[model samples]
Target: MGIRYVSYRVVLLITKKLGLLKNKFPTKPKQSTFITLADWKDTKAKFLIESREKLNFPKTPNKKLKEETLRILNGEICFFSYDWKNIGLDYNWITNPDTNYEYDIHLHWTDIPDFKKENGDIKYVWEKSRFAFLLKIIRFDYHFEQDNSEFVFTQIESWIDKNPINQGPNWVCSQEISLRTFNWLYALYFYQNSNALTEERFQKIMYVIYWSLQHVYNHINFSRIAVRNNHAITETLFLAISQNLFPFFNESRKWSEIGTKYFEQEIDYQIYKDGTFLQFSMNYHRVVVQLLTFGIALKEIHNQKFSKVVYDKAYKSVQFLFECMQDENGFLPNYGANDGALFFPLNEYDFRNYKPQLNTLHKLLTNENLIVNDDVYDDENWFLSNIKFENNYVPLKRTYGIFSFDFGGYYLARKQNSFTFIRCGKHKDRPSHADNLHLDVWVKGENVLLDSGSYKYNTSEKNSNYFTGTSGHNTVSLNHASQMLKGSRFIWFYWSQAQKAMWQETENEYVFEGIISAFQYLNPKTIHKRKVTVSKNEELWNVVDEVSFANTDSMQQNWHYNSDKIQFHTIELQNDIESYNSSYYGLKEKGEGISFSFNKNITTQIKYVEE
Candidate 1:
């Protein structure tokens, strides 16, 4: 390991030690009092006294959704084609759901299974089977246009009975708990007027929420440093929303205040000044936007507010997402780490269809129409029905050839119907993918060259490595190795640094060049420089890659393309060593593109024209 790697580990150790110390110092001392008989009786009697009032649902009645709601109620639940029940897990509700769960006796939390072991077979099942998302049943109420109080109550009660406090797989991560609490709160809000929300059921749900928040309060520091990405933001969002919306408990104000402070800071800290998220994943960026929407909505409801910086960051983040959006197809380029987390699946569109999220967040922020597909009623009905879409979308005016988001480290070259996105910058935080100078190209609405998005975070060791490797992206690789060395499953030891050397546009064409030497950490340093030229009038594009290395005979360079989309085009390669592309995760399709063997220098050219 290099000095940088060693220093990083040392800093990590120190931060973790400090986190441990902070854990011991609670914001307030825990209370010693227990629920007394009189208190229980009073709460029970108050809850039991039925008020003859109709529960107000968040969404207005839509008869068109009855069929879908009925299907969900009939157990035709959809979780990205993987249903929980089909995974063969028992539903006893009195014990740990994962039969193979092994609790860490000392830590008081169930240990996560090694995803690399068993060829990532166990984690594949467990990650999908974790019933945390089962709470999506609340969306059914939106469909039926009525509250399913009993259904929501039973689900929570059963979950609580099965997964004791900090003992099961669901209890392992405060992030998951926070998400569940948010969804549960949604259910309560939607079904507040239901008679099924009896005193007992309401109290039980409150107790569960209390337990979840307590776990978060105890482990906040861990989320602060180790998983300081979106996980920390989500936990704080839960604290803010819960403490603000459900303020009956004595700790609510404290929770709200702390949550708001951290959340506002994170908005500025995690999201860059130019609107790009630090995590570098488009999907994770959407998650942050979703949480922002939820948190902002709750704050509005509770008559609370965040600082102008938080709101400004949120607005810019939404605009970034809006710009990154693809043509009318609703699918943004699958760039960056994607773990298939469709947070708040309050819509019927495909998980990859980010239109719902973009539209929802845009409306939430500006109260002006961004892009409204009539088919996006589900997300709008649930989150932004109050906002009016008065303005119709006018086509975005083109601003000549090349546009670069300097702060985001992305360059967009557009000509008529073609667009290219080049990623070249040192990440602001931990990078989940080892892609440096990666390019994503699109023709009109189709993906011609794509960044085969991250498939799974934890599958087999080889797959986990391959999916995140530089070879999996449309970039240059040296010595058949990634641009940077892998530090762990989700980190690179030596982060690659990239800089734009040239960006010039002429009357007929646009030219862009970037230099990146991420492989300097290797013994004999190597550098790769790439230049892209696109003709404005012609439907043609070209790329040239030049490399400088000591042992050219031992080096390999490649240019990858989306094999699935390449079906519509013809590929010509000169001086290519080798080429292959995987259509999906864990499945590589060979002989799909060009790869090259180097001899001190190599030149490559590709022409893509619409058929």
Candidate 2:
């Protein structure tokens, strides 16, 4: 680290210890009072109210969606795929249902202890506070032609009554606050015409929105400077878009201006030129895509324009994710740290499916669909687009070849029914996982040799280390240690850098070769070089791994696979072990994998076979 960055960190630590950061974000004023929309001089609330008519919501209820909505109505809240039954239909906003750990609602958000030291994960408490389920309920009500505004408004009122401004775990994260504020706005627009949306209710909701925006604005520097990733993008985009929806607020114009500036800057900084996100996670990248969708769509509605760089980055982002996609199902390789965050899920698709969000942005940018298939994912498009929903799509012609994103350090080898994905990157920003030189293979829409998904961010040391370490990926780890030195949570001492990477395609086969400087903590000379070759006609792959080091004698090569389909051919598989695979957050299943130990080099052949 440079002395400048070291000094910045030291200064931030001192300021935090001195309660300077807390002083910037003040508590809600005791005399804070709600004002009706009619009382505002310049209000765009009517535009939002009338915008509901343009929404192309599903006319009939989806059975599964209705079931989930009913469960939520019956006091069951789904947290990271686990249903916590009877979390109270009104909902307890400050309690972790998993551990029954209730946070002190009276304490300032800055006073909350880190979840690692506490009994439960703070995310579990923040989940319900995100108010994502309210969007689900609103969608359900729209589909069934039923008015659940009374219930929805009651829930919002209950949350406000419980969580004071700048207090409790819900207020700790600016990103979470942004998400909650947006979700509330979504519900408010959908229920604007309801008799249940009385003047009193509107005043209360708008008051909370005003305060939430202020909170995010005040704490914006925290995300921008310290946590410069998706969190920064989310919070900044929230402030930018909130200006359009809630112009009646006093600081809306100034907030939106600064928000627009930083939002664009963040997009340029965090989203690389090739559209791979700085965070290096498929799910986190999708989060930015959704934020882009929101920013672009909302700006268009208000007849505003962001800089051309914004559109350029959005286009590149769409193309990057599209190239990584395995098939029409929109599943990408679970290649990086995934906390299972889907900021705006407007469709009924699985969390891994990227078609809805990706296609939405692609259409917004180019007026053409990225996926020309029969699978319809128009929910997001309907919500974001001004035009009515239509199944007709002018498919954008995309040429698929060996695609390499040099800036983001991703290489893709495309064949008829399979593609090989590799990650070798120099970290201009903080890398999420120590997974340089990791490889993922997909055959016929199924991941044959896969990257083990991130299970959870905060967990037991062994689990956390396993999921984030190089051992969980299809790569070579020297001395059974990660390629980079793990520091604290989400921190690495020495970042692995890609020394050399290349991709080539001939008439018969596609090839990729990459080398990364690794394990500087052990020896600066340590390096891991990997080469992959895929046959054009046959479902076969060859991976050669070479590790050079000063002191280490043995290097371990790991591969995770769907044991039912993939078969190994060249290398002898030793230490066949059962591992945990978590495709979704808060969920893991037993998976099979094997490791090969070699002194200096090893070669492995993987082939897909019929079950």
Candidate 3:
């Protein structure tokens, strides 16, 4: 780290600390003066009163979607692909369903810790408050022509009555507050004409919205300066859109100006020139894509325009994720942190499938489709688009090739039915995982050699160490230790730097070679250099890992795979071990792996065939 960067970080830390001190004495919003729908019509804000008529849904309700919606209506909440049933009709907004622990609702937001010191992960409490599932409920009503407005508004009232502004766990993070605010706005716009939206309920909802936006606006610096990643993007974009949607608010104009400027700047800074996200996580990238879809679609509807760089970066982002996508089912490599976040779930696809979000953005950008097949996911497109939804099948503009995203440190060797993804990068920003030089291979839509995904952020020390450390990745580790020294909670002491990284492609084969300076805590001169060769015709991969100047007693090579499917050669498999593989958050399954100790170098070959 340079002195200048370190000094900047220190300044940010001090600023955030001072902000928190100010937050210790918080004030609440007073009663709201009622405004009717006619009053809103008089304002210059773009009232989406026609959204219900503009949206085009499927002819019939999806059975599976109906079932899930019914389950939610029955008081069951789905978190991280698991259902917590019997949550009761009056669901407490500040309680962790998993641990049955209720956070003190009277405490100020700043007093609440991110992780509870005693019982559970605070994310459990924050998940339902995100209001993502409420969007699902509204979709149900919209698709089935069911009058669930009473149920929906009742629940919204329940949440508001429970979680007061600037109080309890629900108000802890500004990003979560932004998501909740966005989702509520969606519901409000959809049900604006319904009889269930009485004047009394409208005043109550607007009061909450006004105060919530105030909280996010006041604490925007925490995300913009201290944590300059997707959080900043989400919160800033919310403010930008809210300006046009709710122009009646006092701070709407100023918030819109600042929000639009920073939101565009964040898109340029966080997404690399080659379209890879700085966070290095596939799920988080998808989150950004969804946010972009929301922002761009709304701007296009209102005939507003962002800077050209925003659209250019959005197009490049779609292209990059398109290259990484495995198939039409939209399974990308679980390469980085997987928190199982699907910001807008308008269709009944699996959580891991990303085609819906990607296809929506592509259509919004070019007025064309990225994937043309039998399956249709036009719910999100319909809600966001000004014109009616149409499935105009067009051929994909970009084809597969041996591509290198140098800025983001990802290289890909893609064929008709196979993909080889390699990670070798120097961190200009914070990295989520110690996964430098990690290799992810997929064949025929099956991940043959894979990454042990992040199970959960708040886990045991051993599990946290394994999931975020080098052992969880398919790479070489010195003395069975992580590639970099782990610090307190998402901090690394020594950042890994990649050197001499290059990719080459010939008529028959693709080759990649990279060197990463790692494990300096063990020895100052330790280095791990890796070379990968892929034969196009033979469907084979050969990896050679070499370690130099390592003073450790032993070096180990780790590989995780589905033992029943993949065939490994050119190396002796010793010390068969049981490892955990988590394709989604808060879930894990035991998998098989091999740990081979070598003096300084090792080689392995992998091949997959149809059964």
Candidate 4:
């Protein structure tokens, strides 16, 4: 219907010109510090403004919105989102709450931050001591120095308490990290099942802060992409509209001045000016440093104001989340941290931020006077400061004109990952084990070629087909099971309709590369050809493909490497026949996505002027 009302009003005018709505922030009292609260009673805030005026939903009004935007751009649907799945990909099943979760065995213990560290960074000290042992064994009710004084709970909890009172996606958050980790661990087990009362734990913490603002304002603010989505879940949804949806009611100064002007324009346009969080990641800067250490411990237990430009922009976003860590192995760099969820120190390698309340903050991404042992990372004045945290930053790439099989773009740009992006995208009538324009390197910020993530989809889907192909991606592949899009690709519709990228960076000495195309269903008369070489004697980085297809002939150039951490060092061919030296396999994830392969026809070799 007029291209789905011009693609849902061009994605709400690019999320209202990218400030992504907090109603668009900046109310001033000297640009805010939030404390003003003069009075606020506790009447249970009409259990969330009468459940946000009974949210009737169905707003296709304006004359039934051009026949409901041609029944949602011809993919017709109505009543409560049709068979949904566009990007929600089940969105991590509310913390994968055991549908009888199975496993024969996979153990490798010792981690309370590596029992006390030796050389750290074995993947952030085994996932920050296995997420502090899955939040001390499924959150709340604790005690066990080898067993004693009872207080139990935890079967691997925290998908915001298996999120549901309004369907799931982990029941999205807000209201200050849904009152400290998923509706205060389910309203502190409904105030210890009503026994520990202070008015029954403040009326089950105002019914879990009015059911987390009717499940994040009925999902309109689950932040589909607004208010930069997760800055410690929008500061625990503005600490649940300032400590339990504003002192639990009595009209509460006209809905707490319209939810404090939509959380002061969603923390100044979802935070920036150097608070760094345009969606970049260091495991989401530890959820924006525990949501600014729980709003600095709820402004010391009850003075909640939050201004000083939101406490110096959440203390320069915890010093840009420890200066976006990277030194080959100081750890952290995965750009988008997305593996199975339930994070309670399963082990990434003795996670270290260095104590003494993170020593006022100067992290530079760990090394705080040594401890980790195995992967060996000692700091000895490693602080190296001039303030240039190796910024190559890169985000302004935005072009997307073609790719669902019609060649590529007139030119290209195809940027990737802005914070934690990786729906693992795809296309071609709708293909997707994911590989459109195929990108995966990051450089200096670390990540040499990754994407080989997903493992067990069914016998680990053929060893995760080298991270779903085009030879695991840095672009150009004419063989090795082809692949650009087909089955399993998340629905994009437009996140740049599946690949057509372009890049440049060179004064000379060869650093530039190209992709300008990717996306095909049928259309090939000759080969496809590809190249990305760099090895002036082991600098290591190569891939070249040349295919020919009028009637297929002689072509076999497979160069796959699965182990030995990658050490081939050399290989070149112009026209040959027999070739064998296999070593390719995938599915060793923590943050998967690593690929490299060049085997097909042949006709791509360039040095041009300064090799």
Single out the weakest 10-residue window by summed lDDT for candidate 1.
44-53
Q: Name the regions of candidate 3 deviating beyond 4 angstroms.
A: 1-20, 23-25, 41-44, 47-58, 81-84, 387-398, 571-573
lDDT of 3 by residue, 286-400 (tens): 9999888888777766778778888888888888898888784678888788877777677777788878888877876776777775354554444454643332334356566
Winner on TM-score between 2 and 4 is 2
Candidates sorted by lDDT, best first: 3, 2, 1, 4
RMSD of 1: 5.7
* Model 2 stretches astray by more than 4 angstroms: 1-5, 32-35, 38-60, 81-86, 373-375, 387-398, 571-573
* The best candidate in terms of lDDT: 3
TM-score of 2: 0.94
Q: Model 4 segments beyond 4 Å from truth?
A: 5-134, 137-187, 190-197, 221-340, 343-562, 565-611
Per-residue lDDT tens digits of candidate 1, residues 143-171?
A: 44455667656766766665656554456
lDDT of 1: 0.62
Tens digit per residue, CA lDDT, model 2, 194-309 = 77777777777777788889899988887888788899999999888766877667788899999999999999988888888888989899889888877777777677778888
Using all chains and alpha carbons, the TM-scores for the candidates as numbered come to: 0.82, 0.94, 0.94, 0.28
TM-score of predicted structure 3: 0.94
* lDDT tens digits, residue span 491-591, model 4: 22222242322333333222223332332442233434344534333224444455434233333333322233433333443322121111111124233
